[model samples]
Target: MNNKEPWLAVNLSMLFPGFGQLYSGKALKGYILITIEAALIVSTVALWVQGSLGGFLTGFGGSILLVWNLFDAHSSSRSGNEDSFETSRKAGKDAWLGIFLTRILPGLGHFYMGQAVRGCAVLVLYIAMNYALVLLSGSVAGAILGLAASIAYLAAACCLLYITEKNPLRYPLLHIKYFIAGMSIVTIITFSGALLVRTYIIQAYTLPTGSMEDTLLTGDHFIMEKLSYNNVDSTDPGRGIGHGDIIVFTPPGTPVQEHVKRCIAVPGDIVSIKNGEVFLNGAKLEEPYAKGETTYSGIEAGRIEGTVPQGKIVVLGDNRRNSLDSRGFGYVPVENVTGRVILLYWNTRQILKMDFSRIGKVR
Candidate 1:
């Protein structure tokens, strides 16, 4: 505490990964921490490219670095056996502010208290939990599980902030302006990111009609993959639209709502219907997903024949006889295709809509 400048080391380390140790004359330790931090940054980017779950690694690595630097800064700033820092020793940081900040954003208080790595880790876990909650949106078991996971995350985050702030090297986190700015920035980022992800990457929807029946029930909820047909990103690895794929698209005349149906015939293909059986390219199509023998006879009992026009495709409901689909509405334009239905996701029992099950995948 004899004025070796603990604040300088702490602040520098806070700014980067290992600046505190470097300033405190711990060159080797500083280099190691900085190297690890850099590696983690690279790893995080790679993980994001890999898949959704892998994206969590970046935050995980950053959090670890925060804790290491906090400890390093504290130990290095001490005058050691030389008695130089004896008089410069200071009091611990405010605990109440720690609680308030952590509660607001889970790990932000840790970041403010110089535990950057730990804070980042908490942020990652919190985000992952939120993703899980979104996926498990409509079931009672899912709600309970999501709520428990969130509470646990909150508790762990607050505890980390509390511990970091209580340390001997911690400083006051009571600046109103900084707190307000931090909270505002975080809220904006989180909300905007969520919106982008939901709109462009994936969106969830509940089936309002049993038109899809055997393939997708009335109470089923599914996630739509939005990246490919939108032509938003060329590097997107998802496949192009193919026959038999389930798609969520707008009917030719409907602009206010969307229709979900199976892609029965693509452009240039001839589609013909007879006796509840679909024929493609002059061959009777095999529809393993449809409940061919179970549907009622409301379907217009007639023979129809047509070739799908260029830039347009023909779609049909699984319950062929009972659905008002391409047979009634004409061709669906490719431009109207918004997203592909990739997963079944969730559903409830037909008799008792309250009973739920994770249907997982759609036909």
Candidate 2:
């Protein structure tokens, strides 16, 4: 078989991460590329869980590998010095199958390409990362692992599939019609499932402003539980919004933007800020999360009525110096409350200031 198409190798590598190198018969290089990328990906995620700023810096290695793979694959394919691997392609494997298979399971595509040991190791690592995340921090950590796991699979698939064209298969490449139909189904299912989950169960929100700084920095993203707070009336119990709860809400006048803050006082509760100290119901509220100090001057500074107004909740920012909350906008109406923030979830900042340690629970 005249399977020496440099462009095919390039295209395959372009589709996956290390396929081009494998196609060029550089099996060791291909394996190294995939392994490094997978390791860096999981490492960055671990850094994130540990809340280190180094995650972003470490994650940059994957990009370097991407460029290196493309360049090396082209060079190897053009030269006659390629080391050939005699592995046969398993039946019915191609780029598309590799993509979805790797995307969903992280290493199944490698198994399909006759790299059983490599495939098993990657699969185990990916699954273990997610499982450990779930055990350490529940589903949100698992979700983060899901997002980060792409790097692992992309690199593995590319390396494995680069050699796929050489082997006998039921269908080495997906026909155009099947590819289109398969992609369409995947798109529809993913979109619909995500939409439904976000609408009824949970949704992610990013803090655009630094109002909730230190605790929730600007650009920090969080997961809000909607089942408990969505369209909830004022007098609701059980899933009730209470003091110390972080909530997403639209201040009375701003219908276009949303703000998140800690509920300092609920209906019929008193709140006062004295020189950076918050007094709740006559006792100074305990707040270790408060950034430095609070001031007494805004609409929130003075003595409130003996109780918070009915159907309203008093909210304050953890970073009181910068936050515009119930102090500035008055009490947040029950209807304006969007969702209760259940998790710190995700945080993204500029490369210089990026921190992942802040990703976790809010309470």
Candidate 3:
């Protein structure tokens, strides 16, 4: 008769779908549930990356499945049925230890369970997945690949839990030593991968001021795509910064601070501001996004007359009166440009709630 703890079964499923069923000796049912969960996760992620509204709604379905899995696991454990995986449990294999080791690194739990071949395969697959994630980061393909890798890793852990010898009290202290070693390796690889992705692929930033009002607001959290700005080609406007694009960069005088502004004029363009209206190449420039007035006094007036120097661009904030942009600090070198703002994912204006409507493409 099954003598498993219901609480333990619930907790196992909490870690990942189907885990609790495996713990309850329902191996076939657990595997099927895991496969279903994986498919749901992957499809949801793929749809979200493609900017589909259905993906957002599908996420709620996944959450509902988790609740059902938890309930099923608890009920199965409480039924007192015969344990199907009794042989492994009687052999003194600690399922919890296997789960813990796999949490540290996908294949470590398999090694602990004496499945060396499967363990090696899991490790190799993990390494390859991470390498691919780094290469494809900041793109639609990257998002889908990252989700697939995560699902695969979790599935591998569930597999370990299913086959691992149970009864934690029988194992020696040697398992702890292996866990520590695996954790150290995983930590190094994880941090290095995150650093590479953040540095060369994408990075998150929060707007600190209403400089780009209406377009970007204070407390709006957004992601910037660094790949497009890396090794930019000045001659090809399509590959680099261009007129009307919102960019994050270090203002000319503020080397330590970053600012977000709209590129008003590019190199070789004659720029002049007459009574707050901008003129580019002797023609009136239309700016529907810009607000506020530009004062003709002091340094602001001096910026009114100039041909954008080579390798530099003129930038101005949408909220012109409140911003200290190229008008006050002069031209910004192209090298100071960091990245283009792509997605605004969150807003922190309300301390207790998020403004979901504010989340969308930066444009």
Leading candidate by TM-score: 3
TM-scores of the models, in the order given: 0.53, 0.51, 0.59
TM-score of model 1 relative to the true fold? 0.53
Off by over 4 Å in 1: 1-175, 232-239, 293-304, 348-358
Model 1 Cα lDDT, one tens digit per residue, 1-363: 323345445545654567678767788988998898878866754444333334355657688878778667867966442453344243445443454456667777777677789788888988887787767764565556555664565465335434642434333344223433443454455446545665676677788898888778887877777765775444322225688888888887887578898888887788777666778999989998776542225544432357777777877888765676676777787878878787664665642555434344566
* Residue 86, candidate 3: alpha-carbon lDDT: 43
Clash pairs for candidate 2 = 18-158, 19-158, 51-356, 51-357, 89-167, 269-308, 276-294
**Per-residue lDDT tens digits of candidate 2, residues 198-264?**
6566677778888777777787777776666655564563237877888888889999577889888
Give the clashing pairs for model 3.
93-165, 93-166
| Candidate 3 displacement at residue 160 in angstroms | 20
- lDDT (CA) for every model shown? 0.65, 0.65, 0.73
- Clash counts per candidate, in order, are 9, 7, 2
Predicted candidate 1: what Cα RMSD to the true structure?
A: 10.5
